[model samples]
Target chain A: MNKMAGSSMGEDTIGAIQEGIRNSAARMLESGEIDVFIGYEDGTLPLRTTPVFITCPEDAERLVWSPICENSLTCYLPKFQGTVGVVVKGCDVRTLVNLILENQVSRDKVKIVGVPCKGIIDRDRVGKALGTDRIIRSAKATRRSLMLEGDGFEVEMEIQDVLAPSCEVCRYPVPVLFDVLVGNESMARDGKDPEAGYLEVAQFAELEPDARFSFFAQEIERCIQCYACRQACPLCYCPECFVDRQSPKWISRWRGLSDKILFHLGRVLHVAGRCVDCGACRRACPVGIDLRLLTKNMEKAAKDLFDYESGLDIGGVPLLATYRREDPDDFIL
Target chain B: MLKMAKTDLDAFVDALVKASYVVLGPIQEGEATKFGVVGGEEIKIPRLTTRPLKELFFPQDESLLSFDRSGTPDASVDTSGVLASDGISPRVALGVRPCDARALVLLDNVFASDDYRDPYYTLRREKTVIITFACPLPGVACFCESTGGGPYDETGSDILFVEVAGSYLVKAVSEKGKGLLQEVFPPCILHEADDEDIQAAAEARARGELPANAGVPIEAAAAILGHVDAFGDSAWEEVYKKCLGCAVCTYLCPTCHCFDIGDEVTGASGERIRNWDSCMFPLFTLHASGHNPRPSRKERFRQRVMHKFNYFVENNDCMACVGCGRCVENCPVNLDIRQVLTTFARRELA
Candidate 1:
């Protein structure tokens, strides 16, 4: 398990990508092409990266590119007023596309510097692999393996074993749209079959209806109603969420099972067509809820029934907004 | 001081259970570990629970009172049941870390204050006994020492337990703890502690007391934040940029005690409830006329920092934060509070 892959993209590729990002960001800021550049910087802890906003050319040097850059920077688009330069992974570009299509952000105002993603690391997976009890003092990442060190212990594991679940089934390793692209796109993992993306959803669908209901019920019970999932989602930009509305309240603030279910299901429906499966909601959830189960099913239904995929065709009308004669009406009854 | 063998933990827990105490400890729950009622399973003390210890005293949501308006147009609400401070059973919270224990004391200033007392919180506080496990290993995110707390600090714990060799050197910090020790540790039950055991316990505590990270000048930060002009500091603009306006930091915070009370009605019957609230949320400061004083994430994030450092210190003579580091570990965007504190600590005041 400790053996590193010899053929994987090495540190040289990552360094080149980082350099390219810094050069692009500095040039853009210097030329007045963008007012601000959003990217990742080394976080305080190991295997983590914090979002950094660079408004000056000199500050652009702080930008780093690695598997640890897990946050989708597109979520900040709605909050900005001027032209914004954003570093995006493959999945983040999809979110950016949705934002543009929804008119939440103007396509002209964004300078998208897209990076071909190998895969982002899941901290929870790494924690579980190295025993959660062990405190990781430091970490060093190579091309294919990560070496974690703690007091009296050191462990090395291949990067593939700790990739986020969403990355494993990712069909878009290369950004679908970008104004400027960094790194050799060929170095990224090959795109998987579209059907492969729905494997987990298919397995979940096999469960009995009661089992599915109980699964969600059990998962939602752990939710503390912190709304981290909602806040992390780029699509959930409503001025007032339905749950928070005082007048004609949809879900009460009480921590009841039904109220919790209403909030989760309500969110799933709100982002049904627009969700790009960026894994932000899952990563943001503090309780480790399997939010993708419900979301992926919605994505699959949109694919099977409406033959529509979100954030792909920028000119196409949203799945829910545009109604066609061929659209499935069987659920209406 | 007393000592008990590590192998005798089950018997000790059994003894506590037999004594009519409801024991709660850290239990492994799927991928996450949280504080729950100790059943037959062994209690493995993790560095920290997924959720903080505040939930045991202040739940996420709880019913305050129930009312019925079906009988008359103008009905009198019965609030007597809400504040009834009787019949609360004794509870023992086991394996609490010093940071979390210190947080309870911070919360006590809010919930059990001189001006007003929340009976619901006071009753639980009065009935429960806290048993803290002196930390032997602090995590990467932990900076409890920087926030006026230490690995072996006994601020709110009734009893403090330190692991030494194959046994635990237990020290009673309160009268209730001493009484309980007398009841549980009969002459035949506990081992007589010696100098070697005490030395080992001290070494273990020293290991944990070693700073996990460089200490931030929290006192200096609090002083700077106390300045009225600090509210308009440009640092707030940069510090809050990456914040997603999520309540993960506040809700997971053991010291944050803000709550919202609302009435839920179904036709003629209704129930009043209190739920945890966060300054990170926009709705927390929304005015009736829709004129929010804290209109954006910037103001909200600033309020969170100021409240913990300046306002709380000014009012209660203590900082509200215990530096448990849950916010640092769980922030989706990696907005570290330590960095924010460090920024204010080194800021130049006008």
Candidate 2:
């Protein structure tokens, strides 16, 4: 019943999942462990998804879940008070964990109904991969299989063939912590696939010294400082950001590579160790900057140096909070 | 001690396969010296990183999983099964300035919470070591003392290196720093600091002040917080008028750590993710039902001040700030955070 690679389940499966969510929410609402049930509902745009919070049992009927539910809806947790029930896929649960960590929400304040994640496809990528204007009508995935149907091409692409950048290196095929779990658990990566996007990091390292600077320059040069990536991130929980200072302009308003690189560098630093590898920044970018590269570098650094990852555990302290006398400082004068 | 009389910083870097640590300091990428891991061997010191060093742990964009859209989900594919030994490794931050070191302490309150800890940051914290450089002179954006910090405070460093004439006077503040430097440098004698050295550092700070910022009025952030309700006007609107609903400020802040979660899957297997988020965005305070309590710039603007000055101080006993001035220096539209904070102190609160 899981949506895995190459499985040809249709929109019918999507409907069933939505109905199951709605029915469960309505029952939870009646029981009153939650005052509001936050989940995803279908959008007017084909395959687009929007956040929905159902208060009344009647409103719960509007709840719908689909493949297009791209946003990690934990955006509302801090602003949301009182007891709330949230429908969380494995990735979204990290938002729940983050809120708990920040003390923004009480562990008892929200009830999380967890869903296992197989892997999600990038709608834009699907359109690009198909090399057509036709939108992907629907998608079905199961273990080792993925079936996608677009405007005219009825090709069943391997899920690995078109996996999103963030998914290629996903280490947590499961939630580190959760209140509830849905369906069966995913089997461990049956011995990693070489196509799992490792080449991107290698590609970054493979470039000559000067070429890498150009590569970063190209990415930073495109940033408009819109901060859509920051806003979309679940880790950037600061009530105030630092770029708006006037006494000293840290980054220039002028759209130059220097300012853009400063902006990205500043951004990545604020989140270097905490980045969870969510593709929201890439998806939220209207300019199509591969911010993923910056975070990926940080991710590699975090793993190689600190041996840590975001959202994998519930009780771990952040990397910089505790210092080890013997922690590496080989470059210091 | 391993002497480096001729082998200065440049030669020291040349000794490594590729300086084992990611040397992040001020780089003139564009118009700013934003902090980034050195690509090869580059000497970027004293220059501000356009942003603060806060992002070293907090991050603006991050992923909890790789939404594979391809795997089969069984009970084992859930997030609860994730182990802590999977990712992240130890690293040494190369050019951390003193103010940046203090900023890390400001962030530690939330990061090291006993109720719930941020595992992502904790990993970095335990493994990464900081070697703080002394500020030769205060920048136009600096106001460290006003925020109960200084340009030379060792509140968050493993080692501190003061640039004294021809040599760097290094001191170890924490045990980690001391142990690491045992073999790197001669034992630094702890003594009553000379008044001449202190005076010289102060003189450098005075000389670097800009005319417009020659004498910025200053007061305790707590006294400023007391007037949160007093700054209750359109000053927020006028100041934030140019804001593009972007999260630039929060992304660069040394202490801001708000975030949101996401979930993705393919077949049955999926992973949850948490990425950085901010209150500047309308969606930050938006309820799932479509109602946003912080509906406008005024409320949002005021909220930022209250949290940094009042709420943080009241709760954590420290103004969740370190006066590194990254926010004041990085705004695209030139919306300065310090000016706003000071203005709120002068006009609104006064």
Candidate 3:
């Protein structure tokens, strides 16, 4: 078996946060404050981390914090009937907040342990950097760089060069909502400029309507209709998605371009204002479709049109669920 | 064994193309590597394609038949052109991994069974010649050795290509492969492999084999899972929690062959189609009477494991999984099947 090892820049800080999470989780589990603790554990492969659920106090020691801890544990929030103590990064906590706002998960039923995040390492970018065909045998990440090793090759890349696109423009490196905060909040990396987040969306919007349509058509054509994007998003918690409905079958099972487009467009509209730009959908896609082009556009529209952002306030109403007199009515005509 | 220089691979592909063979290999498709028609593009065989090779034979969605309401009902039904052999041509699938090649054999048990045969699958299987490339170094997620397969196991390959020093030692595993080799390389072009070449290939095979300790006790897990009481085991609750109910694992798995048949109707015409179905989907087991035996993700997840490890073994005398590690590597939640098997292996059967 190949030996796998990983180290991150600011190892000391990450270690402290992980330790803090373990201690708090153990304490909560033993005290019956929560039935399960959701966090991350070492994945089988390099440059990956899998969500881990700890039901026993002893298992809290398995909780880990790393740049690769990218999953939003809030996706599992609605499934738990009892109180859940879940570890959340900045982006993930927003998802938790969205779940609470939407009433999919009761705020009282979840104990959020928030860790200030730097950024997640994008595996796709790393793969591209080291030629897609090169099998990564082992990976080592330092504070600012990553060293990848294979059978006969080794490549080193700066940490900033391989961060998930969502992370690069993150506006919140520190969780806005948390019951227990791990590590000093002040130690978190400074958030990037808010407007800079939508630069890609703005550039995409500049394309002619035909060009945009064709681009999306080409992208959605590769979809195998796996619904990984919907399954990965915490906001997409409907009991039965429209695509899966039998009576009103919105989309057929055929691998046709129209049905594929309908599924993606429908999903984007469904999660229009609720998506937190967590990048889970893109990461979950096995085919690596650029799902953010549509999702991020909806996010930008939500912000620009309604001056609204999701997951910031638990008391806030969903964007589509409410209407105001001040809301733009020109589009209605 | 016949030796082919590393530099002559393109020419060999050209020879196959010249012989009217549609050559398919691992081609980079945007961000993912997939088995696609290789015209003149470089065929860089990754450890494994992001998508499985099964797609070439059994597509995700295929039309079974088409019918028109305007004509007489009996006469309107047409199945002649649906996946017909008129356009079907001889094809070569190159750079197939041993595990994926093994997966085809497992699929053959289902699609080309003694009791029933699927013409679509049988036709493709008969037309395509598979050339498997032996892995010299296994990836982190690979566990083919644990499931009665290995990096160099050439169970279903027509031809096996073992990378030796600066060249490939190609061995024909089937008569079709031998005939193809004779046509492509002939006697003058094909050089006999030397002892050094054979020794190097052996060493490479050994290097790629998974360490004995790395394997999960799959056989023991299979045995335990076969019992009826295993269905109600509490361990399933924990194992199924992390699954996001996504079809990534099943879609990418080479051995997963379950499919759903549906009819798409238009104003005056309709087409019957079959699509790949996943046990991970909530709708896969929904009965017409609104009764679903596997109602929740827990039961669905159990069915996936049970079908692959227990039921398949019972039916075919072999596990359905090929241990290609696609699920292990691509699962969003990192729900490792190896760990699931280990949990069952260590469980006390009820």
Highest lDDT: give the candidate number.
3
Model 3 sits at an interface RMSD, in angstroms, of 1.4
Greater-TM-score candidate between 1 and 2: 1
Which has the higher DockQ value, candidate number 1 or candidate number 3? 3
DockQ of each: 0.58, 0.05, 0.74
DockQ for candidate 1, C-alpha atoms = 0.58
lDDT of 1 by residue, B101-205 (tens): 999999999999998898888888888889999888888788889988888999999999998888888899999888888876556557778998998888787
In candidate 1 chain A, what residue range of length 10 has the lowest lDDT sum? A1-10
**TM-score, structure 3 vs. true:** 0.96
Q: Write the per-residue lDDT of candidate 2 for residues B70-146, one digit (tens) a residue.
A: 44352444332332433254456657877778888878888877766777777777777787876665554567766
Candidate lDDT (C-alpha), each = 0.86, 0.61, 0.86
Model 3 segments beyond 4 Å from truth? A1-11, A140-143, A152-156, B73-75, B85-87, B186-189, B210-214
The order by descending lDDT is: 3, 1, 2
Model 1 DockQ class? medium
Off by over 4 Å in 1: A1-11, B72-87, B186-188
